[model samples]
Target: MNKIKNIHILILLIFLISIGQMSQTIYVPSIFNIAKELKVNMEEVQKLMSGYLLCYGISQLIYGPISDKVGRKPVILVGMMIFILSTFLILFANSLELMIILFSIQGLGTGVGGVMARTLPRDIFLNYENLKKANGFLNMGILVSPLIAPLIGGIISNLFEWRMCFVFLLIIGILISTTIFIFLPETCTKKQIKNSIFGYKILIYKKKFNYYLLILTSGLSGIVVFESNSGVLLSEMGFSNIEVSILFILPIPSIFFGSWYIGFSKKSFNYLMWKSVILCLLSGFFMWLPGWFKIMKIWTILIPASLFFFSAGMLFPLATTGAMIPCKGSAGTAGALLGGIQNIGSSFIAFISTFLPKNGQFSIGMITFIIGVIIFLCWWKLSRLEKI
Candidate 1:
């Protein structure tokens, strides 16, 4: 592909990558309203997020081998079709249970598109540094969803009904699906698809790359745990829908900057992960201290949370790329497992988080500490064993 064509495809890939997060976050500001409308608890409403994530994680495992068997473009289109159907169907859901089921299906729809997005730069870019740079750009594109989704969801929900948010998502799904059909080429052409079970086993059970997989999963879980709770917590603190939405957008600029820095610097993934470990510890301390002291100010959450998100800026792309390093012939399978592993940890934590004390302030702090330590130790062990 020519340079301009590559840029267009890259943008589309970013759009695909952003779809799952958009599906989740776009509806977030309206969760409280949905609960009130259904006469349900906010905690029950929060299950929608957990449901989407659980489906999102598990679905990736399926898409990887199938994409390897069929092709990236076909798998992506099928997934997006599922997303479009599920998202549009969400409008007819009359109860919370029905909505939860539909949303999980929508999450399943995002898996193929999202996993393929990760494999693109891995497919096209040869050098590790070049791959990291591409992923940074991809991460920067993802930051746009957080920046834009809440703002749009807030305004729509404030002006109309909470379900209106799905209308917006439905449109996005259609557009993305169309774009992929028209433009995306297959990246996993050379790899023959084995049995789905074999695909996952080869990608995930490998000793060499398992360390990166664990860090990727754990780090993502911590991030989601905090995010899953933030909507309710902000509402508890007396913020309105619009206010909560705006607050959620705050961390993107920092994350974007971090990704841009990594791309510009051309730093290795190992280098960036090592540097971020300290930032993770610092974020954990500040994050934990506020809740431990019962400090309820927004900044107590916002400041530390922003710091940790910025660390994610550094952390995610590196770990994702590292996880794929050993699986050159099976990018789809590896990407799927990596993404699936990511959501498994995150969704489980998010589900578990909902059951914690309503004052999840302290719980988030504890999460930060534990997640930070585990990621750092994983990196240390990977470095020692792999000697990369």
Candidate 2:
């Protein structure tokens, strides 16, 4: 019975991770066509993305504490159900305003998955190495969805309509929720549950956890910056939706490779973290590289995208582990707080990146590089603390 219980929890974790991946991945390609259909400016549509993400980030604080009290299974299922309903609304959405509202609701669902998925493994797997391995799997699952989103979105939009993209999300959500309902067991113990909701405030006060949180949150800035800028920048450079889709896939292989590399290594130190930061700097350099020589081409943009994605893959797991390691008995709160910072910081990055000049590829590249460097400085500060 004990052995069976462990298997059930592991499967549940994987399923939740997949759902988390699906929620984020399903919307990327549809953004372009959806904006056209809604008859709103692209920036208005972009605000929808920002709204979902910010809400998703903020909801982590609420869900994390609630899950610790109510039990993981109930919180997760409620989140999944909400997500399914939101996706359905998005499928039939007619106006830009409606889509934005539904997307924010969708953010709530995705936010729950994000917090629970991270917290579940930390609850089940105690050691630093095992925890890192579980996180690697979670990250891998999230990355998998993006790998296919562009292609799937392209085909569906071409054959039927952009609305089908949400329809596809509905199908995926139903299947995932059903699997969780049947197979997933509650992982939290009664004693491990928080005595009060205010426990999260105590956890956040820890010095070590706060530094790591800064790194995890800042690292995500690059992703948001890129997402907010990519469609506009790529279109200006003569890439169509399909062409952008193909270019988007360029980074998946590199990301997968980075995750695999991190997983296989036994060492978990500041060195690997620095390597990720350096790669991010290089990615920024590559983004500006073509523009520097005045020879902007399709490959120039694609290559930098590939580099940035890979660097992100390398940094995320390490930073996550660093943040959670200090929490001791508060995995749920730690996961929630970490995820909150990531999404909130990302929302800010996406919003700020919008202010950059649209015509300059170098501007995007430089902005990406600056974000990477800021994360690196956070990493450096954390390293100094570890030494002391």
Candidate 3:
């Protein structure tokens, strides 16, 4: 609308969506190194992840509603600045105590860009099919970053130090901020939220919105429980950082399949959602198999995990697009609430998975199975309320 090319603005949005993951994934492989430098055990080292995720999830409650009021570009620009400043500060952390606090603050910045990034697609496309295609591209960016983040982090940490991950983030912040300032345009049609906290009631009160929110929560939680732990789990199985990084990339083919299915298939959103729910059940079963067998091959984890994430990745765009559909006035707030639920749900589940028995992978599988069943049952019951 601002006469900027849609392609340019869209590319910027996809990149911005990667912020939360890049913040954590790039440093995930370095958790052990961070523990060594900070003098802590692995269980305690995990709290850093929990702290960052908690802040990232909680801050989205504010980011979405505010974006609706202020317009999207300026909110993202300010967030980028906050992100850069916070990452720069982390470069100076000398103790685990200071690192935890800094990373928690970093999560605050993580909330800034994602709320608006998810909103802008609806702003631009304004049609369901086109939005799905746009969301496919958006989901691609989201999934691909995880594939690359750890690889990049592993290489950087191996060549330099874990702190270099922040250096990478600093450059990304500057670049994305510059892009938003120069090229990205405002996309909101109205500001309906009077108060951010109370605003969610308006959204949740919408028929089927809460169902979609619950679905988003369940979907992301499934993926994160495995993702947050996989790097460390693979490392414990005696693989090097590079090996874990490479194995993390195995899901790419399936994820691409899922994205492609959502973007190109003519199936109704209902059809897609049902397919995803079933996949979650199957994925959970397979995810549990690796730990059940007590086998340590990367393939044991990789094959089942790929199936689950493929469905998860496939569901990613659908869940987002569907959830925001009914809330026309508060797309920002809608996207924010959905994102917050997703991050908070996934973070909590992921953190809990790390603490579970049998070094967590077995519990990870059981939880994944249990959650998948719950999601299916919720959908089955809610589908009777009204068709999504």
TM-scores, each model vs. reference? 0.95, 0.92, 0.93
Winner by lDDT between candidate 3 and candidate 1:
1
Preferred candidate (TM-score higher): 2 or 3? 3
Task: Say which candidate scores most in lDDT.
Answer: 1
lDDT of 2 by residue, 153-209 (tens): 767777787778778888888998898888777788887846355876786677777
Q: lDDT by residue for model 1 over 46-162, one digit each (tens)?
A: 899889988998999889877777777878887888998998899888899999999899989887766775776667776677677778788877655755687789999999988
lDDT of each: 0.79, 0.74, 0.76
lDDT of 3 by residue, 84-134 (tens): 888899999898888878888888887875676577776777667777787
Candidate 2 accuracy as TM-score: 0.92
Candidate 3 minimal-lDDT segment of 10 residues: 188-197
When 1 and 2 are scored with TM-score, the better candidate is: 1
| Segments of candidate 1 deviating more than 4 angstroms | 1-3, 190-196, 266-268
Candidate 3 clashes between residue pairs 3 or more apart in a chain or in different chains: none
